[model samples]
Each structure stands twice: as C-alpha cells, then as structure tokens.
Target: MNYTDEEICTQYGDRPKDNRGAVSPPIYQTSLFTFDTFEAFTHAQLYERENYVYTRGVNPTTELLEEKLALLERGEKCKCFGSGMGAISSVFFSLLKSGDHVLFVNNIYGPTQQLLEHLQNFNIEHSFSNGDVESDIKPHTKLIYVESPGTMLMKVVDLRKISTIAKKHGIYTAIDNTWATPIFQKPITLGFDLSIHSLTKYIGGHSDVVGGAVVGTHELIDRIFTYGFQLNGSVLSPQDASLIIRGLRTLPLRMKQHQDNCLRVIQYLTTKEEVLKINHPSQWKGGAFSFIDDQMTGYSGLLSIELKEGGFKKVAAFINQLSIFKIGVSWGGYESLVNSPIKENNELELIEQGIGTGIIRFSIGLEGSDLVIADLEKGFQALHSIKS
Candidate 1:
C-alpha cells in the first residue's frame, strides 16, 4: 500500500513497527551486500542495477534517512552526505562549471564562503548579491545560492522574489535552509530548485552526529546521485544516518521548546537596558527576516543579541561567566551555545548588521526556560560589571 508522506515519515522516520518491538530503528552498520548467483550479481550491479555496490553508493540506514528527508522537503528525491558542506559542495560541483557565474547571497555560512573562494580559485566565477538587487544577474549567471537568516547575524532574503528573478534570468535557485528547518519552512514549495540542510543541527537534534542532505526535484537529485555523489564520495555513514532518523522523531517537540525559549529570551533582551539591538526575525520590519510570512511559523533555537557597549571582548567575558550556555561553533543541538565575531577582523562587517563586539548569538536549548533565563541574567550582570 502507498503511504502518505506524513505516514511514511512517522512509520519509517520514527514509529517503526513492533515486530522486533524496539521503538528506535536499529543501525545497519553494514558496508556491503551480497547476491545469490552470477545472474543475480549482474542484475544487481550492471543489468537490473537493483543492488548496492558499495557503502559509499548507498546504505539501508542512510536510505531510511533519505526517504524521510525527501518527505520532509516535499521533494521527489534526497541525497545524504557526511556533512552539510559535503551536500553543498556536491550540489555546486554537479550544477556549476568553469566560467559559469554564480550569484550568491552575502552573510552566508563561513565555511560556504570559504568553499566558494576555493571554487573561484578553481576558475568558477562568483558574484556576491550583497544587497537586495536583481539587476546584478548577468547572462552567464547559472546559480543563485542563498542562506536566509544567515549565520550569527539574521538576514532574510525574499526567496520567492529572487526565484522569479532567477527564472527570468535562467538561473537555478538553491538555498541553505539550515536556519529554517523543514518543520518551519519548506524552500521547495517557495520556488527554490534545491534545498540543502545540515542535518547535524535540527535534524540530528542532539548534535551527536554530523550529516547533511539535499532535497529537490527528481531531475536535480538524479544528477547529484549519478555525478556529484559518485565521484566526490562524501556519503553519510549508516550509523550517522540512524542518529538523524531517530532525531527526526523528536524534532517537532524539541523545536517547540526551542521557540518558546527563544521568544522569552529575545523578549527579555528587547527590554534590557544594555541591549543595543536584537536580530530575531520577530523584530524585522516585514523584510526577508520577518517570520510573519506563510513560509515560517516558528523560529529556530538560534537568535543573536547585541550589547550597548563592549564588543567581542565583553561578549567573551559574558560567555566565560555563563553557567548554562557553552561557547561553541555550531548550534541546533539539545544544549545551548553562544559565540561572537568579536576577535575577527570582520568585526566591522558584523557590526554593519547591527551586531557589535558585544553581540552574542544564542542557540536556545531544551532546558527549562526559567533556569535558562536566570543563567543569561547572570551573564548580563557580569557584562554590566565589565562596563561599570
């Protein structure tokens, strides 16, 4: 029987059958599969092509995660990878070529920008879509890559409008939808050709595993499945895929608590005497960062806050003083994390986004809201002492 996407996800992503009686899906942890006969081997490998040749090509555990991811993104196909960068780089290499110009959004993930630089070093031309301008698209532009609510600073881009412009210019649109998970935003439904995710974040939920996924039209996925994935070979391990699958079961629940905590935290920050700015989408004036649109209902666990004075040094002091939030590089895990760009030479660039040296990015966790708030308040008290 054919199952609906939601039913398929519930059954396969989380709610497995009680035949074995285990609630969680078991990790296959296998590297290879065998066939019964020579004819069967040929059928699986060459003629019929129904068998798995290598773990790099496919795994049952990874396949389960891919199926759920395709359902989550409302796409026909999905590809899993070792990390978010793997997925993104595969998409780039699959779709782009030398001399093909790319219109990429500014304020994207740091690693992505680094990748683009490396691509440029390899002769692929790229242009930054620094401001909201469609006139920048050139005839050679082949792809428009965007990451809405990007990085430590939250900056939203009009995906639909950009899609229209890209279509007119014959450019394919792709997005790093990590900030707005599928539970809140579906980039495919909003006109993106491909949507990529760092499943290590919200999808993995606990931040125990590192993985990424690309979900999109069957045609685009087919190319990646055949060309990008086959050659570069950054496939997600079967064990990691199991972690993401298990995490999917609790995504909705965890995201709700994350939003609740962020709302309270952002609201409190807005009222703080020392806070200079808050970059949460809830505070945006109906631009790309505004979550009032139909594309998003709830915010993710991440949000950024700027202090009135002191830059990264004070932000670092506050972080060192914090008891609950750990200073880390990544977010979207069960625990909280905070970081800033205070030490970087790009401090002025971040400051341009209303983020100061004292600006601190917070990833809310499943911890009790009251306790989280008290911990943050103590950090703020420390910040005040630094200023005094």
Candidate 2:
C-alpha cells in the first residue's frame, strides 16, 4: 500500500492504462483539444481551469507533469510555464494588487530582484531583509518571498519562522525550492503557501529543457492559472513536458550522486589554504544552520567558495585555469559549471552584499569527485600566480 519516493518519481500518475498503453507517456502535441459536441465545448470552456480546452490553458502532457510536481511537493494544484521567471511573474501578478508590498528574505536570485524593481512601476513595493522580519513587516505587506540556500552565499532562512509569521499576519509565503527540490524539502509540509521550482534545472536533469512550475493550494493555484498562466499565455510545450517527465524518473539517483560528489568536493576545499570559506549547507558550522537537517534530507551540488585574498583578476585567473569544470551559468545539469557574482565593476554592490571579489560558485556535475577536486587544485594554483 505504501510507495517510496523513487516509486513516486517513476510510477505515480503514470499508468499505461491510457494512450494505447504506451510505456512512455505520449506527447499531446496539439494546440487545442476538440469536443464532439457544441454543448460539450461550452462546458469545457466554462471549466477551462480543469478541462482540456487549449494548450495555453491546459495540455494532458503538461498537466501530467503538473500533477506529478504537485504530488512531489505535497501541494494541491500546480501550473507549468515557459520559464522559471514566467512562473514567478505569474505568482506576483496574480496574488498582488496595486499598492501591495512584498517582503524579500535572505539572498534572492538576481533576476527576481530585478523583476521586483520592475513591479515598482505599478505602485507595488518591496523590502529586502536579512532576518529582521519584525522591522520589515508593513501594513500593506501581502507576501513573504524567500529562497533557502539562496544565490551565491547559500544563505538559508528559517522556513518555519517565515511561515508562522506570515500566517499570524494573514500574509502568504512562497519559496524557491529549486535548490533543494521536493526530494529534500517540501515547503507545503513546512507551512509555506507556495513552492516554486525551475524545472530547467535538476528536475529536467539535462540542460535540454527550460521550464518552470508553481505548486500550492487549489485556490491560489487556480487564481494564478487564470491571470498569470492562461491570460498572460506563458505555456509549457508538450515536448518539454515529456522531457521533464523523463528527467524526474531518475531524480532520486541523480540527486544522490550530486550530493555525494558535492560533499567530497567540500571536504577537499576545507583542507586548502586558498579556500577562505565554503558556503554550503553541509559545511555550515553555527547554530543558525542547525535546522538544516530538520528541514532538508539532502542538498544540491551548487556551492561557493571565498578565496583568502583576491579581486576580479584573481578570481578570473582561478576559473580560467580549471579544465574539467566549464565556466558558465544556470546550474543543475550533468556537467560541472563555474561562475562568479563578483565582477570588476561591481565593488559597491559586492560590498553591499557583504561578499568579497574572491567568491566562486560551483555547480558540481556527475563527474567523479576526484576529477572535480583535482581541477580545483589547479584553479588554486592559478589564484596564487596572480600575486606575481
């Protein structure tokens, strides 16, 4: 009667009973579905949110992916979008009205902050807070948006604290759960109102697909579906949906391998003189990160390291020296990647972020741990030569 997480990933919501019993879920590639009768067509339009009307509103392929994602996150409803920002924008446009305020916690994604700045044109406002939730809460605050193990530093905010505060004040809370995925952290179980993920990352496993999803209660999700999803028309294609489903089938196996490789890399970094600090959940040393184990079962391979001393040229030198790791952006793939938030012209912003120019974020891939560590050793040598 009981099924395991791997079973849920591979088996749940996928039954061969339909579609001529094809072992793989067939892609319903049509733009719209037709009803046999006009009366049936009207009925479908009336219940467009639940019925198969058009691909813009719903598609069997995307819907299957949505159902699986909702189940994975333990949420009631779900919506898929063309990109992660599309999902995020829909959530913002659907839930927020004129003059409403949003409270951003910890280090949020750069593009997300840019989107919030854009919203200011419509009279919506936001405030970024480290941990002082009490000071930031305003009378017009409508939502508390946060990212755990966020951005480069991997700063984690207390989800329980955020949810409880939001509920006490009648505010909705949402989290970017892409880093942890549903495999490690279920925001709904932690009392968050909405959980968002960039399926282009780990859920897709491969870098071939670019999609996003939002999961939460039926009421909120339906509202987003109407305004943010259907009306705005950022829809996920059936081809992408099928691709994401294939990725989900091996999520358990891929995630475990990523974690194993990351931990090994972290251990090696801790022993190096060039590494000033390792920014990842497992390496967190203080009580501030104590709830990590309680909230998450595991972590992703994404992490950042601060060099003992460096600037833009030094960091660039280190990254340029790496062979196995490719210098790039947008992680959560089978290939290792390297990037830096610190740039030559962003000194003031870096100071505001409280990070140095020496930070390098790494996205460890399925490659062996020994290969990753050996490349990093070369990168450190490049860092040292910069002094000359």
Candidate 3:
C-alpha cells in the first residue's frame, strides 16, 4: 500500500524490529569486518556495499542509519559523517574546484562560514547573497548553498525559489536542514539537489551524538560516498550511529511536545515588557510565520528571542536564573537549554555584523508548557530584577 508521509514516518522512520526481535537496534561497535577473501574486500570497496571492509568508509550500523535517513529525506542515497561540519565539508570538497563560483547565504551556521574561508584559500570564488528570490545571482555560479530559517539568527530564506533559480543556471543546490528536520520540512521535495543535516541536533534528539548526514540523488551520492567520504575518513561511529537511530524513533513524539512548550514560552515572551522582538516563525502569516507556514508543517524545538533592555549581563542573569533550562552550546536534546547567540564568540564577522549581541536562543525541551513558561517567567523576572 502507498503510505502517506506520516504513515511512512511511523513505519519506517522508527522501525520496530530488533536483530533478535529485541525491540531496539543493536550498536555494532567494531572497527573492522572480516571479508571472505581479498577479492571480497576488493569487491565490497569497489562496489560500495554495506559489508564493512573498514569503519572509516562504511559500517553496518552507520549504513542502516543512512538508509533510514535516505527514506526520510526522500533521496536516492545518504551518507553519515563524524560531525555536521564533516558532512558539509565533504559535499563542498566533492563538488567544487579552484576558480569555481558558489553563491551562498551569509546567514548559515558559523562553521559553514569557516568552510568557505578554507575554500577561498584554496582559490575557489564565492558570492554572498541574502538567499531571497529578489537577490541577484551571477552567471557561472556553480552552486547555491542555503540555510533556511537560519538557527542562530532565525532568518528564513526561500528554498524553492533558490532551487528553481539554481536549476535554471545548471547550478547544484544544497541546504542545511538541521533546524527544520525531516519531520517539519523536506527540501528534496522542493527540488534541492541535496539536503544535509547536523543530526546531532533533532535527529539524535538527546544531545548525545555529534554526527551529520547528506542525502541526494543516487549518482551524486555515489560520487560523494566514494570521493568525499572514503577519502576524508570521517564516517560516523557505530555507537553514535545507534544512538541516532534510537533518537529518530522518538522524534515525532518529542517534536510535538517541543513545539507545544516552545509556543507557550514564545507567547509569554511576546507579551512581556522586557521583550524587544520575538523571532518565532509561528507569529504571523508572511513574515517569519509565512516561511514556517509555507515550508514547514511544524516548528522545531529551536527559537531566538531578542530583548531590548538586555545586553550580555541580562542574558547571563536570565540564563543563570533558569531552573529547568540548562546553559549549553548545542540544542535539540531531551533537556531544555539556553545560550547567548549575540555574545562574543571567536566569529568576528558575526559579532561585528550585530548577529551575536542582544539575542538569546532557546531550545525548548520535552517539558510541560506551564512549567517551562514559569521557568522563563523567572528568567524575565531576574533580568528585570538586576536592572531595577
């Protein structure tokens, strides 16, 4: 039977079978696998089979996760990496050469900016645009890299428009879909060449693993699997792979709770006197809300809140006073966490551009909305308390 996306998500997204019917995927944590002979190892490597000749190239545990990811993204193939940056860097290295031009959104995750820095040193040319349809894309642009509803800043770009433009120019299109996750948005369905993820976030769902993935057409993925992954030696560990697989099973349930709690917290913040701006996509129809409405079925656990009266001191105070939310760097775990986005990070361009100064990001967890809102209330109270 042809299943709806939701049905497929239930059946395949969280397959209920164990190796011995144990009800959970086993963690195959071996570094090497035995081959029948040298010829078998050669064939496995040459043919790109899942039979593990080496863990750095492929592992059975990681391969299963990749298969599930390919299904989720609706791509012909997928590959996993040690970290999100690894996945991103592999894609870039595989596609671009010296003097090739890539058009990119400036508002992506900080490490993507770092990747471009290395690319520039390697003699690749690039253009930075707003990633909106209105922006001008020059001829000879070999690729268009997009990050939708950029997490740290909460800016949404039109992926479909950019994808259409890239196709017209014969330019490949890639997106960082970490914030939206497959449950919320599927960039491949919108005609992107590749959809990448920092699976450490929502896919892992528990802040336990640092892994990344790339999904694309079979031809492109085959090339990446061989050249980008096999050569780079940054494959996901079998243990981390198993953790991510477990996390994926609970993603839909966790997401529903995350959204419910985040919406309540956002509502509370929006009505507060200390708030200057609230940057949740569900706030309207065409602005930020429009992007979420048009592109995503539901918002993830992430959101950014901007306060007018608070600088670093207020942000720090708020973070310190939180009872339920923890202070940490990454999000999309079972626990709620808050961090300063506009703080002084080593990323100088981001700091100078006012991207990381008066903003605080919240990764709402699977907590009770009323309790989470109460915790936020205490934070606001502390912020005002210090000022008073």
Candidate with maximal lDDT: 2
For 1-388, candidate 1 gives per-residue lDDT tens digits of: 4555446545755445633767777787888777778787776766221357678787777887888888877888899999999999999999988888888885678788888889988678887875764878877888999888777777777777788888777789999999878887888888889999999898898979999999998899878977778789887999888878878888877888899888888877777887888887767765444534866766887988877786666777788888899888889999988887778466787667545676788998888778788898888888766742
Candidate 3, number of clashes:
2
lDDT tens digits by residue: candidate 3, 1-388: 3444454434553345546565565677888778778888788877655566778877777878897888888888999999999999889989988888778774677778777887889888776784354355665577888888775777776677777888877889999998888888899988899999999998899877999999999898888887788899888899999888878878877888888888878877878887787776676566444555667888877888777765667778888899898888988888888888545443465457666455788889887778788888888888767762
| lDDT of candidate 2 over 1-388, digit per residue (tens) | 4457788789887778976787788889999998899999999999987799889988999989998898888899999999999999999999999999999998889899999999999999999875789678999999999999788899887898789888999999999999989998998998999999999999999989999999999999999999999888889999999999999999999999999999999989889998888899887755887777778889899999998886888899999999899988799999999999878799678977888778899999998999999999999877767762
Index of the highest-TM-score prediction: 2
Ranking by lDDT: 2, 1, 3
Q: Give residue 138's error in model 2 in angstroms.
A: 0.6
Q: Give the C-alpha lDDT of model 2.
A: 0.90
Residue pairs whose backbone atoms clash in candidate 3: 342-356, 342-357
Q: Which sections of candidate 3 miss by over 4 Å?
A: 1-18, 131-135, 287-292, 344-356
Residue 362 lDDT, candidate 1, scale 0-100: 90
Please give the lDDT score at residue 279 for candidate 3: 73
**Clash-forming residue pairs, model 2:** none
Model 1 poorest ten-residue lDDT run: 42-51
Kindly indicate the candidate among 2 and 3 with the higher lDDT.
2
Predicted structure 3, TM vs. truth: 0.91
Give the CA lDDT, 0 to 100, for residue 161 in model 1: 78
**Cα deviation in Å at residue 329, candidate 3?**
0.5
